[model samples]
Target: MAAEAKQSSYDGSHVENFEFYLQCSGEHESILHFLMKHLPEEFERIGADKSGLAVLGVGSGGGEVDVQMLSLMQSTLSALPITADIVEGSTELVAKFKGLVTKTDHLQKIPFTWHTMLSEEYMQKTKGRGDVKTFDFIHMIQMLYYVDDLTETIKFYHSLLNKNGRLMIIIESANSGWDTLWRTFSKELCNEILPVYRSSSDVLASLKSLGLKYEEHFIPNTFDITECFDPNSKTGQHLISFMTGRENFYQSFTPRVRADILNVLRSKCSTEKEGKVSFNSEMRCVFVYA
Candidate 1:
């Protein structure tokens, strides 16, 4: 059973904490690989030259994408200057990312640094100091929602970018079939649903208003509900991840709503003959000039 959702300011630490969703996911790594390819295209558009680029990973949870991007950056810029700073918003994830770099074998490929701060606070501080033009690339991966103002964040990074620097953002695509189903059935399912800061459509419109253009791409993810009931093949990972998240936001719900949510989740996750169980996550790669 879970408690109600907590009614607190979005913690800076939730970035990496949220990565649990992907970590427990079976098809997450492949989507990550796809994001790398999409990212460079934007980097090139901003005239990065793919060499010696100083990159910032804003809200870089768990340093997963930062590590992958830095590796790709190293390969692309062997002769040029290549340094990366992964800025995390979560305390635990910041620690996890640092630990990962020191502990991971392949981390030696790229030179990198780590910092942790809320995107909004960091932007405010960076602005106050005029230390804005420090990065050639900044990635706000699934993080802008935590901040109260999207325009301020957009403007902040827009200023921080060096000449031809690029800003890339990644967020869940809310217009997918899974999202549709989640919204429709979630009320009946009694399963816990986490809140998203921006809907897919809203984010798209916001980016568009900034005069920044983006290419839409998706990394398909699935919660293989069928695997859940099979104790032999039981991936307790999904259940645990879902359950844990429910635990955090659980307190926000009333007992009656909570039970209804979980009940529907179990049935929806049941292995029926025509069990359609794939949630498509759309990742939009937004690119702007330096």
Candidate 2:
């Protein structure tokens, strides 16, 4: 029988690990480029004739992406007043986000409300209230993997959008390395108790099933995973842990399981050339309109 190792989502305790993962993943650059090239038109479509906007960031981590998106929105909308609500589960990440906001002078003009809670909790709290606040823009970036119910979560967020509002979701593409890894080893690596290992393909399927209209765009990205093949590398181990959503994966998983995972990662999820492995970290963004 396979050994049953403990599993948990990233939080304050694993903030460093998550940050390291982000640094190695090349995801930030891909997302930023996509936003810079495409978001102005999106903002124009959604913000036309509007003097004010309510924006929500779900699972916003460290606020780097949030700040960039908000800055673009401000520039595109020029004179519009924007209010941002951030929902993040990690205390450490929330503190980092707050600190980033404090240092950003342009963001100082915009009001931000922080909710240090998970998206599910925030959704429940809002739904339970006598008066529910609607939003003009909502972005859930690379965060749906932690949700309990993907379909229900999409439905809830969609319901919160005002007419002409936009709900943007970014996740791993169906053809990305993440999708390949999770599809191959979900039974071995994914936590059975918590939601994890989902990709953009799953999100699109849900949106279609719910009778929602959405547009999808692909962002191609690649990252070096040569370190991941080296068992002695601490950075490699952290990257592996992040990929598997299992802390200390190299130390915790059985030797057989670990070896199998490494084999799959190298041969299936990434390309190796000249002794270097490049992971196909492509991502997809889905835009749904209300």
Best by TM-score: 2
Q: Write the per-residue lDDT of candidate 1 for residues 1-290, one digit (tens) a residue.
A: 11112213224433333444555555347557676667555545544454467778887666766777766655554565666777665566777678778876666655776666666666667667744547887877666544567776777777677777877766556654334434644443233223433545656687678777455556555554544333344354334334334333344556576555445445442223565433333444455555
Superposed Cα deviation of residue 153, candidate 1 (Å): 1.4
Alpha carbon lDDT of residue 56, candidate 1?
81
* Model 2: per-residue Cα lDDT over 54-164, one tens digit each: 999998878989999998998889889999999987777788899988998999999999998888899899989999889999999888877788999999999999878
TM-score of 1: 0.72
Residue range with the least summed lDDT across 10 consecutive positions in model 2:
1-10
Could you tell me which residue pairs clash in candidate 2?
Answer: none
How much lDDT does candidate 2 score?
Answer: 0.83
- Using lDDT, give the best candidate's number: 2
Every model's TM-score: 0.72, 0.94
Candidate 1: minimum summed lDDT over ten consecutive residues — where?
A: 1-10
